[model samples]
Target: MIAFENAAYSYGGGELLSEISLRLAPGSFHFLTGPSGSGKSTFLKLCYGELMPTAGRLTLFDREVRALSRDDIALTRRRIGVVHQDCQFLDHLPLAANVALPLTVAGRAAPAADLSDLLGWVGLGQLADALPPSLSGGERQRAALARAIIMGPDVILADEPTGNLDWDLSLRLLTLLVELNRMGKTILIATHDLNLIRQAKSQLAARVLRISKRRIQLAGADL
Candidate 1:
């Protein structure tokens, strides 16, 4: 569903990603691992069209990313769900409204029943009426996930999704991603948690990619 050919990205006269090439097949599951400032987030941004490469080509869902217009990218984003390190939510809005924001921004209204069910799925059913500041870190994360998938996106990209959670909470989030993959949603998660990656491997066939030296390589260990 996504491919990068000899892609390179640079900022402030420094190259963070260089000549990187990758292909994510439809319904495939993959994990991206790297140290801080190692370009994992940069690569994910490139994949989702947030950052255009300085050179080479990035193809997301068949069309070249750089060639896509702003509106085209916005439309394409509806088919791609993204969970960021810091869950972006409207501080004043209720959790349910936050989860439903994607649909609203896309000019579609999600049914009230479906919205409630989705919030329930993320264990936020009761917290739907609460504002973003009232929720804990894990709660916000799940809320973000609910928002991302509410549109029934074909692909899910998560960057440090469980960064603030404990081991148990992290596993819970991982389980949700695995379930999404089982349902044929392509998944790419960027995280520094090797143990989480190992846990994911035990339950699913997830390819591990490590970013280093300005390129991406398949991890050699069973990570």
Candidate 2:
């Protein structure tokens, strides 16, 4: 669904990512690993059109990202879900409202039953009325995942999703992602957690990619 050809992104002095060439096909699961500041998040941003390549080509859903208009980019984003390390949300909004924000922003109304079912599926049914600030780290991560998928995006990009959670919570989040993958969502997660990647491999087929010295490389079998 997304392709990068010799894609390079530069900022604040030099390139953060260079010569990135990869295709994220439908129903594929990929784990992106790299050391801190190695441009894993930058690559994800390029995939979703949040950032454009400074050199080379990046395309989303068969359209060149650089050629897309602002509205086009916005429309394209509806087909992609993003989860961040911070799980950004309006602190004062209730979890239900937060999860429904995508629908609200798109000028669509969410059915109450569907909303309830989604929250319940994420194990947040009882905490729907709680404010985001009141949630624990794991709760917030699950809420973020819930909000991300509410739009029914074709692709999911998560940057450091398990960064703040413990092993158990991280595994729970991974399980949710694996379920989504089984349901045919294209998944790309950028993380430093090798153990988490190994755990995912035990349950599903996942390709691992690593970034080093501003280049992307296929991980070795020993990963």
CA lDDT scores, all candidates in order: 0.92, 0.94
Query: How big is the positional error of residue 220 in model 1, measured in Å on the Cα after superposition?
Result: 2.3
Off by over 4 Å in 2: none
Best by lDDT: 2
Candidate 1: residue 111 lDDT (0-100)? 97
- In angstroms, how far off is 149's CA in candidate 2? 0.2
Candidate 1 C-alpha lDDT tens digits along 54-169: 99988988999978999999998999999997988999899988999998998889899999998888888999899999899999999999999999999999999999999998
Whole-model alpha-carbon lDDT for candidate 2: 0.94
RMSD of 2: 0.9
